[model samples]
Target: MTRAKRRWLPALLIPLALVLAVLTGSVQAGATVSLPPKTADEVLAMIARTQVRAFSGTLQQTAELGLPDIPSSTPGVTPGAGTALEFLAGSHTARVFVGDPTKARLQIMDAMAERDLIVNGKDAWFYNSADNSATHLQAPKPGAPTETLPSKPAMPTPEALANRFLAAVDAGTEVTVGEASSVAGRSAYRLSLAPKDPGTLVASVSIDVDSETGFPLGVHVQAKNQADPAYSLAFTDLSLTAPDPGLFQFTPPAGSTVTTKVLPARLTPVPDADSSPKAPSPHGTRVSGEGWGSIVMLPAAAVPAGLTSNPQISQVLQSVSGGRALTSSLVSVLILDDGRVLAGLVPLERLQSAAAAQ
Candidate 1:
């Protein structure tokens, strides 16, 4: 949830969050709990206050996507998971963000018999192997508007839903029983949930609770996409502890193409525009990208409009180390180093102070 890029994938595939949910529930068989179904409102209440000090795990996302007649101007509409990351979490410690691209990190799919997309924070100078580009513009202020998953879906924020999911389970949302099944090689209980609202991106999810621990041993999100098929996620290798602190940091190698952060032609000189956040670019290009694994957003919107993209994004990145995003609605870009810009849509001053954590 704390990841700046945290978001839901399309219906064809399950959003990345399911991996987090399975890890939170059902620890070991020895640590099982009784279940009494709960409701949406009730579930929300419990998640709000749960203390999550640290987390780490392997995540799996598979989806069958539905594409529109026209290309989507939004995220999650894609038929495939846009990108996936392996993480090691901590409250105050750093977590390595692995970029396992089926295309970039996922590149292994081309070589290995059983494709393995694996990138480690400790061994990821590979980010610079690709052509990196960004636009230089004044950082925007905070209070920008981001359209929800569906253009009209009224889903709650991760912050809002985190506590709710737990609360709903504690309160017992109506749960129905299903036949036994083997998921990821374990006997588990299958629960079918009839959502009160079909409009939910997730109409039904099959939660595989470990028969031994009473906890979720494996979870699956089966999305319904007519436009694109093959969107669903099955997450294996779950853990509830923090990963190595080194996973979150990055250092671009020498001889990389550090392009300039350019501003869009549409947004250069607005006199009365409200605070706008530039869409931050990725550390890697679209053909391939590298995930920071763990993300901590510093509000740049609060800073003075003087904060523009690194005048020479290439020079800044080469001078420094690590990678980040510099984006806007018109041109969302990712910077590979801290000196690189992380795009937002707010005005520079407003976005600079978007958060106090920075």
Candidate 2:
């Protein structure tokens, strides 16, 4: 893909991915259980101290984000956009296997076709059965970081999603422990995070932490004023034992077209307390504000020119004063006439103001 084409992928997927990470199946509520109580701080500490490195589980995701359904067969719709819409509106099921820090696999089961993402040591592959295509990426070293593949929409595991929310815990958020519950047949404590800022579209987020292993088995995100969760991902079945080593192996079937790429030795690293903040990109992409109300700004040069003209995208965006907007229960995206794109959990007015200020 060309640079312009690659740039559109993240801009289009990020908003949806932020809300859709983690696959799901049928909705299943665990039975109520009685367990020893722990303070919010203790539960957070437990999650931080978790030692789990390998497991296999069946994950189910459900979203009631109130997004309009866009069929995959729609004319002028790209496969990527179609898949993103499919994930944004309904329930999905996937089997996940993790052997270690460097080995993992996710099988997204569709009715007629299946999508697979496998990461083994420094090698990663994405396969889409619907089109009989595969993309292979090899890193320079065994521990090199892998970039997100554009071929398929990959969702995170519950443990991965839990870590993301936990990292944002601050004075702007209220943390508490809810009632004890059972998830995947294991006793767990419910850790709740409520944003103090009422301006955020998110109302609260709850995570179920395993009592014995301290691993997260589920994550539920509730949107403000919504009766159901805007997004929920949980394991319907779980096992701590490592999966079969053979599961991580992948080979493109006969007649499948395979694309190969070699990744660099190092990728961008997450900044830590001791590290200096990185400078903004040449494209002028930066985040403004803080906490739950923060907004992401991408200058005109960063946004793909054809986004607004795409039929599938145009169907969901409504015209506003200065641009087109896509709004969901948890996120809002604004595409200005000037070609800039602004998105966040904040309201549309917030994005408009940010655009005007620029």
Candidate 3:
């Protein structure tokens, strides 16, 4: 994958996965509340304090976005199962440890191999056990204020999803508290958020937060008219103590190919602008409005060769004219016939408006 795509794909998926990652196992519906659920205002207050600076846990992520039939890996495939694209359609498990924002580690367990992202201070290491390869990326110097990076974007984590959506708290959102529940054997409070905008496809989102420290234990997203969550992530096992420091250290296995990248900070910063680049995003993503009504413009060229070559992709393409619209409860994506891809939390019409302008 291109470095550009690699940089943004994770960020794009992580948050949406909180809202779109669909899991298969039955989520125990009934909760025996050890303590009564908190009020909405109380839950909101707890969210702010739930910044887990040190913790280790095993998280399960499931994606049931009702996406198009995509490709998977075979036995002899080199970059076999668990490719990033495959993350959008199945279930996966991850081992996560966070010492702080700059010190964290995530290990994705696959069928026969795994991928590890280790961040320590300003240096980040991405190691793929499948290929025994590593990518070393240097984040901006500590205390630097620049927002954009020339080489790669910031690494993403499940915790960031909690902060991202919670930061959107405003008059446009309706917050409430659901029944108390259990996650990873710990008691948690269910906090639900629903956009007041009728145009949004998101029906509602509920996050289960640890009652003790307030860290998010699980996130569930429900789409309009859907009974089950379109995406979900929850911990099957968790610990509040710090992770071993050695987990954040990496030397790259012997004979492993290592690629080094230096990220240059952006000259000017625009808030909430789309970071992903496509054919038409020559100057980066152009964002309109904010919060619930925001739309992102992503003009692109013709269909990418990678997509056209895949029979399943081609068949899906044949089902559409110039573009295709995919919708979940919280987001909408418009893939234009011109190869441009527009996405946002707004309705299909909003995305069409952005594409029409391009």
Candidate 4:
């Protein structure tokens, strides 16, 4: 547990297993995966046509985190942050950028930690300069959008988070085919899926299939059972045939200050904090009640105006690069690369009901 404390231990436990990938993405570790022998329904229908093609490479990732049940006042196990994913495959749109590229959600929550997400397509932007805030989420045109998807507690459809990050393979899942490995050099086949109800998932993956240009190179996921760790995104150096809508345009680096909000989070119910489990948190540790960073982030905009965004009110911000502490929750909100704003407190009925709902 040393990679910056396993990158803030999955942003304080994927805020309740961001749809529970804690260990639910499935890959069955009993080791018996070997395929090219076909049949299990033609290897699960060629692993359901693997996707995200139209490549333009550069996706480097590393993880060793698995907080099975942290609750000793959190913070301190090590092994964190080594994620550097980059994407650019087009034709429906995909131009996702993540952490360390001008503050790509640093401070440990890999894949854009302290906020800063701009997923094109159904349009999604989550910018939080520590609470000066910004949100503009639409996400719902393929079918099903009654709103309310804070991190998928019981909502699945957007084609199931776009086929669980592109590995497809559905029949209710249970594959396991491994034994052909190569990764970035192609020549792959390592099918894994194990959601016989491991709560819903804790592993799901598909990789390499060019026994002769059958397409599909790599893909992975691990969620649900907590420490079910395994997150991969790759394109190698692609060009199958797609990309160039001006590469999904997002222009905004000149004076960089644009705001919009709405997605999974966006609450407005307050009053409570300072409940005193000996109270502390924005890093002082010793916490109780709400989880995640446990609270802190202020340099002005001391979060209180009818304060919503809760599970227990944990959206500490204060960003825009002049002062820090861009914390998270409400399905992540760390935008200016969250680091520094922690002067903790979190009970007293959720801080007097979020300061009397601000």
Candidate with better TM-score, 1 vs 4: 1
- CA lDDT of every candidate: 0.27, 0.70, 0.59, 0.32
In candidate 3, stretches whose alpha carbon ends up further than 4 angstroms from where it belongs are 1-30, 69-84, 140-158, 264-284, 299-330, 337-340
TM-score of each: 0.33, 0.82, 0.75, 0.24
Worst 10 residues of 3 by lDDT: 1-10
Q: How do the residues 147-167 of candidate 2 rate in per-residue lDDT, one tens digit apiece?
A: 443232234777767766665
Q: Quick one: best lDDT, which candidate? A: 2
What tens digits encode model 4's per-residue C-alpha lDDT throughout 1-358? 0011110222222222231111111112222333365433444455455453333333333332221212211121111111110111111112232211121111112222233344454454444333334445454434443344333221111112323333223334466665666544555555554434332223444444433354544444554444534444443433444544453344444444555433332222222342543343342322222322233332223232322232122323243333332221111222122222222212123322332232
State the displacement of the C-alpha of residue 265, model 1, in Å, after optimal TM-score superposition: 19
How many pairs of residues collide in each model?
Answer: 101, 5, 13, 83
Q: What is the lDDT of candidate 2?
A: 0.70
Give the true-structure RMSD of model 2. Answer: 6.9
Q: Better model by lDDT, 2 or 4? A: 2
In terms of TM-score, the best-performing candidate is 2
In candidate 1, what are the lDDT values of residues 160-254, reduced to their tens digit? 22222222231112445555555444455555443333223333444555444444433333333323212222324434345455543344436
Q: What TM value does model 2 have?
A: 0.82
- Model 2 per-residue lDDT at 44: 84
